[model samples]
Target: MFCNQCEQTAKGTGCTKVGVCGKQPDVAALQDLLIYALQGLSLVTAQARAKGVSDAAVNRFINEGVFSTLTNVDFDPARFQVLINEAVAHREAIKLRAGLTVDNPAATFTPAATLEGLVAQGEQHGISEALEAHEDLRSLKQILIYGLKGVAAYADHAAILGHEDESVYEFVQRALVKSLENLGVDELVGLCMECGQINLKAMELLDGGNTGTYGHPVPTEVPLGPKKGKAILVSGHDLKDLGLLLEQTAGKGISIYTHGEMLPCHGYPELKKHPHFHGHYGTAWQNQQKEFSEFPGAILMTTNCIQKPVESYKGNIFTTGLVGWPGVTHVGKDFSTVIEKALEMPGFAADEDKGSVLTGFARNAVLGVADKVIAAVKSGDIRHFFLVAGCDGAKPGRNYYTEFVEKVPQDCIVLTLACGKFRFFDKKLGDIGGIPRLLDIGQCNDAYSAIQIASALAGAFGCGVNDLPLSMVLSWYEQKAVAILLTLLSLGIKGIRLGPTLPAFITPTVLNVLVENFDIKPLTTPDEDLKAILG
Candidate 1:
């Protein structure tokens, strides 16, 4: 088995024997097969669009298909197998109406896969195609593929909120089709940029859906303690799901605490108003294996960055919306399974004081104070704005982000979102004109919020996002980070710095394309990078 679709790919090259993420060879092949099947489904979905089919069901297929392939999102073979079957079924259903034959895609595991059954094989070898492809070609293809995964994850969250963007689905399918072939670098690169373009629209739709549904998020302090009695820790990047859980558990004695990417949920006005919503627990996604072990409550993963579970207290963990683990409880659309599991956990201490941590300041909430922000800028009270955002992962150099945040000039404002902020989210960066520099925007999906705030600031300054004395020093660990990077490039944002490391899958040629078009550079150090960015 060979896999290198994440920050921890073995040796900074590829994971050849087994995934360092604990994904075995068979699991890797199954994931590839799942992507293969999704491409077929995407072909059908794309064709259906040509024939003018407009239904949430088709869009749902695209959303889920792309979503299921994101890095560290889903690891259940049963669930992966189910999605493959569902894709085949959906492809046929759409093709029957379109009068198409709907043959299986060129790159799939056949029923001959029957003998292998994935579980029994446990350690499958990588396909020669994936294992032996030219590194640049593979890298570019992976970029496109991974970017779509991010798009799908974001689309799924919005679909739950009843906000479905058909354009996003259509693009996801089309991009998947491109990845399923020997498409030349030029064509693949075009599709990669298009992924960026469409992602912008997709993000805008999600932004509208979130603010429209939850009202604009406002800055609020989130408690950082385990409330006395029953509590559940909600992780990953789905605000709508967290909101629903908050509503359902409001007075039922089940307290909700945000974990990882969900840490920013505390700032949303609608969600913060809930009496039972406690506070953030733990720092970032990477620390979960240790942090979760000590927590007494159940954990619910709504999306990505989930490592394989540990033996102790494994059953207390539950997942939904494309996040799956082999032994963890799988919650359906209703979340009853998660709620039920939370009730069964060892639970909390009697009379325990709830902890508090501050959050919110998402795009809308921050923009609501645009006038004040503008005034602060004019007064030179806020000399610089740093958009330090992206995903989190288990990597050594990631400490750079924490160090960088700690080293930021006091007059600057650090606006962050996604799990990466955990590097410094708890640092208490103080304030400039009564506003804390360490402002947490919602989830990774709320990368859109950071974009919105950046764009608004640019407009206020009569400049483009890149020209606003703002630097986007980002760290990417997964596919969702891919989507956000594409969105930034799509907007022609320039001179942004990205690091801990470059994706092993990214070829020098594709990297050049990104550099030539977007002027993105790798991160060096706080002193060096800050000087380059701020000077």
Candidate 2:
């Protein structure tokens, strides 16, 4: 189970035993196999496109396959195996549909005599195949795989909001087929950059979907304490789920508290309008085990970053969407079970603080105030736009984020979200034109906001996204972050300093692909990274 597509990979290398995220060997292997089958699908789809087959079906296959492998998305091996089988079946069906066998991962579309070969192939020893590749080649392959996983996640979110891009899907299928062949460093590097470029479109689509559906995010205050009455802690990056929960529980004496990535949802106009919506409850995703214990409410997870659930709060943890575990309640599109679970739990204790967290600073809102921001930048009141975006982890060195934010030149504006913002979100980072420098832009998905803000600034100043005075200093802990990084790369954003650690799983081949193509360098000291960025 050698997996390392996340910042929290075991010891900053690979998770060889049980995943640090609690993914067992079987699940990891199935994820790998699922990806392998998806490659088959990608290969066939690419071939079909040559013969006039649409990449749309193949795109959905890639999106689901990659998304199924994201961190904390599916720890249930049984479910993942089902997905793998389905992907293999899809490959066969694609061959049948296209009137072609696509017998192997490397083969083009050709009708199969039986589904037996593909199914038998999937059930075959995963490790024997895993061990056949050169370590570097395997690593580069995984990098492409992880990048697609990231892109798929972004695409999936957009799909949920009804903004689908056919080209993003085609790019994913093309990227998957490219990873299957043994390519040289230069070729692999080009493919990696292309992956990144497509991700930018994926992120934009999702950003448009989200802001279109929920309105822009404003700079709002989120309460850090607990709440009173029947309550549920909602985690992850999905605002629609929180909105649904808030709607079902409206006037029902049930309070919904934002947890982890959901903490930024407090700033959205649609989500914040809920009177029953309570303040944030815990610190970050890593602190859930401590925070959930003895917490007098149920918890609803709309997405990833869910580590192993402890016994005390296991019953309290219910999941919807793609987030699933072995024993947790799986709420489908219908969130009634969440509502029922909320009703069953003791209502939140006597903790009532009616307040709002300022947000709505997405592209539309930020661009609306473009002149003010530009004036601040020109006057030196806003010296820089510091995009402190990405994942948050339990790693000790993550303290660097807090310290970095603390030490950044006061005139800089801090745009942050996802769990990473927990480090400095509570701190006072001064202001730029009466707006707090520490701006929370939704969740990890909202990294799109930072990109939008940068693009707007570039347009305002007549430059590219990378040419702005904005520096992206990211901290990743999961695969969704992988997708976001790919998006940044797809946009040609350069010189991103990623830390507290690089994925242990990325081989030298994959690392070189990223470094050479994007000039992506790891973080040194906050002082050194600051010097580099400021320079």
Candidate 3:
């Protein structure tokens, strides 16, 4: 098995033996096969769409199926076999419905009879085989595929909240088919850009779903301290799952604490209103091994970014949605098992005041103070704005983000989102005239909020976003970050600094095209980059 779809791929290259994410070769092969099956489904679905016979079930399944293959989402080979089987079932159903037949291998592909057979078949359809093309073309195809995975994740999240866009699904199917073609560098790059634009739409729908379901996030203070009571730690990026757990656990004496990317849930009015909803725990996904082991209660992984659970607390961890582990308990809507586990475990014995951090500075909250922000900018109170955001990983050199934020001029306002802010989230940056210097802009799922805030600020100042006094210093760890990068480029945003390292799949030739076209730069030292941006 060879996989390099994430920032932490083994040795900065493909993971050949086992995934650095703890995915075994069998699981990796199954994931590859699942994706191969989905491509076939997409081939048929694209034709069905052309015949005006689109199915919502097909669209939703494709989105969820594609999302499951993303790094660190599902590590269960059995689950992937089930998904592969379902993909073929869906493909066949759609083919019969549309009364059309296609000769493409992907369109006519069939799943193996058993799990072992599926894994064997999957090995034949791995990433290396899929991209048996020119190096530059393969690089562009990898970018497109990763970006599509991100789009699917966001689309699945939005669809869960009843926010469905037919065009987004249409684009997903079309792009899946496009990846199969022998497109030139220019055309493949164009598809990558198009994937970015589609991701923007998916994020928009997600923004609507999140803000629509939970009232727009308002600025709120969340504790990093411990509370005395039964506890359940909710991780990953699913607000709906978090909300349901919060509702079910209410009055059961269970205190639900946010973990990892779930830290921003405290800002949502509906979620926060739950009296038992407690504070945040841990930092980011990569630190979960130490963090999860130390947690005093049960853990529920709602979506992606799940690392291998340690033996000590592996039994205490439960997974929901598409996230799965071979031995961890998989949960459904009813979280009684999670609640029971929390009840059986020892929760915080005593309350402790461990200070707090501000969150929920999403678009609504930030833009509501547009006047003050504009005044601060005009009065020279706010010299510049730095959007230091993206996923946080366990790799070395990530300290660059910590140092970058630490060295950001006091006069500049720092807008951050996602787990990357964990580096300096607790810093005492204070506020300029009343606006906080460091603004927490929700989760990576809420990137649309950051884009909206920047667009609004630019609108108020009568200039393009690049013309604003803002610089983006981003750190990417997975496919979601890839999609976000594409969105920024698709919007014609420039001069963005990205690190800790460039993606292993991005050949130098492809990197040159990005540098030449979008002015994208690899990050240097914080001091050097700060000076470059400020000057």
Clash totals for all candidate models: 8, 29, 1
Model 1 agreement with the true structure over 382-481: per-residue lDDT tens digits: 8888888887777789889998999899999988887888777778777887887788877777877787788788889898776787888899988888
> What lDDT does the true structure give each of the candidates?
0.77, 0.75, 0.92
Q: What is the RMSD of candidate 1? A: 2.6
**TM-score, prediction 1:** 0.93
Rate residue 491 of model 2 by lDDT. 72
Error of 3 at 390 (Å): 0.2
Identify the leading candidate in terms of TM-score: 3
Best of the two (1, 2) by TM-score: 1
Candidate order, lDDT descending: 3, 1, 2
Tens digits of per-residue lDDT for model 2, 236-323: 7777787888888888888788877777677678878888886887778888899887678788888677878899989888888888
- Can you tell me which runs of candidate 2 are displaced by over 4 Å? 55-58, 105-135, 352-358, 463-467, 507-519, 531-535
After TM-score superposition, the amount by which residue 254's alpha carbon in candidate 1 deviates from its true location, in angstroms, is 2.5
Worst lDDT window (10 residues) for model 1?
A: 119-128
